[model samples]
Target: MVDSVKVAGIQMEPKILEKELNLERCLDFIQTAARQGAKLLVFPECALTGYCFSSLDEGLSVAEAIPGPSTEAIASVCRELEVYVVMGLLEKSGNKCYNALAFVGPEGLIGSYRKIHLPYLGIDRFATPGNRPFRVYDTPVGRVGLNICFDVRFPESSRVMALQGAEVIALPTNWPKGAESAPRFIVHTRAYENRVNYIAVDRVGVERGFRFIGQSKIVDYNGRTLAEADVSREEIIYADLDLKATREKRVVIIPGEFELPLFEGRRPEFYGLICERGESVEC
Candidate 1:
């Protein structure tokens, strides 16, 4: 496995109900990023099918199967370029539809992560909640975890991936206007706390009266901003990630006077309340 790899995040605007156009645009970006030496390229949430659907029927209409046409096209590109790609798309499985992210390598479809936490905003309101557990996949680059959009709001999501030895967490998001602070603070917080590379790729442009804030970015394991895209424009941000750094979880401040072990020091017993459902507990 390589110790370091170049990654890119594509920030673009997708037209609503125009799956064909969006797919074409995504293919272009994939080729461009791959040409620029990005081994792992990430795209925004709903990159293939736009978000903000009015009903489940609307989402299902454009939703495609995970290994269907869209993925086959992407897999062909990956094979040609010898790179890896993580993209967001609405998945249709029988009568159910879910917000999902697909991981594709040069070989073919690697894995997928369906959004587990559904929010009231956008298509997630009408889409089916994901049933799969959080997982990390071993790849040529490093141990990678996948999560979409609102999943980052819940610390447990990334924490679970971090616990599973994920070195890079790829997040495909569709952040809207008035949500600027998400990339500014929360993204960095997740990277710092978990000591894993966090790549959040967001879409831009207004769709059906709702505006999306771009600001797609990639943060290193030490919480440093490697690259960030413009807020209102379509662009690509690139960063070279060192996989070895993510494996070093120990922090030594002042040479032992202040030491912190991020993963080894967790107290699972006290954190059990986090898994409780249907009841609110006072802190």
Candidate 2:
């Protein structure tokens, strides 16, 4: 595995329900990020269809097929530049619609992650629920995880990814403006607790009634904010991540059945008593 990889986070507002214009901007940004020596690039959530749009009709009308035009365009870039890309899209799955994150590598369409933990605001009304909470994909840079806008708030999302061997958790977000501080703090906490790198990409401009906060950030395992962009500006945040740095700092065993199966031997029966109290609340 490579010791270090250069990555970039794209921060720009998307057009309201305009797929053509949004895709044009996506291609342009991909090229720009590629020129900046970015081995991996990430975009904000609901990039295909502007976030906060009124109806499922809008998401459905703009929804694309995986490996469809959106993925195809990015695939060409990945193939041509040999760089990996993670982008957000609206997916029209049978009988349901999903807010999905796609991972494209040089080999073509790598895998896509559907957004779990939909926000109670408008997304729950406009989008369908995801079956799984977290997804990790293998890439040249290392194991990469995908979590859409609201997934990281739960902690279990990032924890599962890190336990699953994800070196970096790339979040595609479209955070609302005026609330930048809290989200910034949250991403760092996720990274700090998991001992993994966290990259969050968000948009800058306003669409419909929602104005996005544009401070795309990358945080290290020590809860350090490595780089952050301004909340109202359009810019790319770039950084070179040393993959080995995470392993050296990891000292805890956060065990989960899906990703951290190594902890299966650990006193689950002993811990079951503790979980029973919380299980009623969770279920």
Candidate 3:
């Protein structure tokens, strides 16, 4: 894998139920980001199809199969530009529709991640919950993990990826208004705790009466913001990630007294309470 790579987060608004127009805009953004030297580019959740669907039928109407038209078109572009892309879209598999992210490279479709955690808001209320375990895929850039909007709220999602040797965690989110703490603080906390690069790409504009907050950003392994986009504008944020630094989880802050052994010090036996089934608590 390359030691350092330039990555980008495409933050744009998608027209509701306008698949053709959204695909066109997504292609344009991919081309633009490729021209700017971004090896890996990530788009927001439902970047091709807008969120906030009124019912399951509405979501099914726009959902497409994984190796279907959308991925084929994006794979062709990836082949031409020689860049890897991770984009979120509505995926239709058998009789179920899922909130999924597709990873495409210069060769073809690499892999995909179905959103495991489903929230009550937007299309997630109607989409089927993902059944697969959290996974980390090895890529030309580095080992990367995928997750969507509400999935970030659970620390185990990112921790599982980091445990599997993921150097970067890409979160394609649709963070609506009244949830500013996620991008402002949680994103950094996730990266710092895992010692891995984190990229949260969010869209802007109102959809189905609910407004989305767009503060797309990329944070390094040290939990420092490398780049961030405006809250209300369409923009692309880029950052150079160092693979070597991300792989080194241990941090020696004070030589001998305050060294942080991020991975080696894990006490997994006491964390079984997180897996025990119980009533959900509302914070």
Which candidate wins on lDDT? 3
Q: Write the per-residue lDDT of candidate 2 for residues 1-283, one digit (tens) a residue.
A: 6667888988888876888898889888989989999998999887777777577876688887787888988898889998998988888876577888889988989998888878755445678888765767777887799998788877778877877877889999888865666465889889887878888998878776777778889887677887889978888889888777666542445534334322333454654444343435442
Each prediction's TM-score versus the true structure: 0.97, 0.88, 0.97
Candidate 3: residue pairs that collide: none
lDDT of 3 by residue, 122-184 (tens): 899999999889999898989999999899999999999999999999999999998899999
Candidate 3 segments whose C-alpha is farther than 4 A from its true place: 280-283
The alpha-carbon lDDT assigned to residue 257 of candidate 1 equals: 86
**Winner of 1 and 2 under TM-score:** 1
The true-versus-predicted C-alpha distance at residue 17 of model 1, in Å, is: 1.3
Residue-pair clashes per candidate, as listed?
A: 0, 0, 0
What is the per-residue lDDT of model 1 for residues 235-265, given as tens digits with 9 covering 90 to 100?
Answer: 9999999888888888878686888888889
Question: lDDT for model 1, on a 0 to 1 scale?
Answer: 0.92
Q: List the residue pairs that clash in candidate 2.
A: none
* Candidate 3: C-alpha RMSD after superposition: 1.8
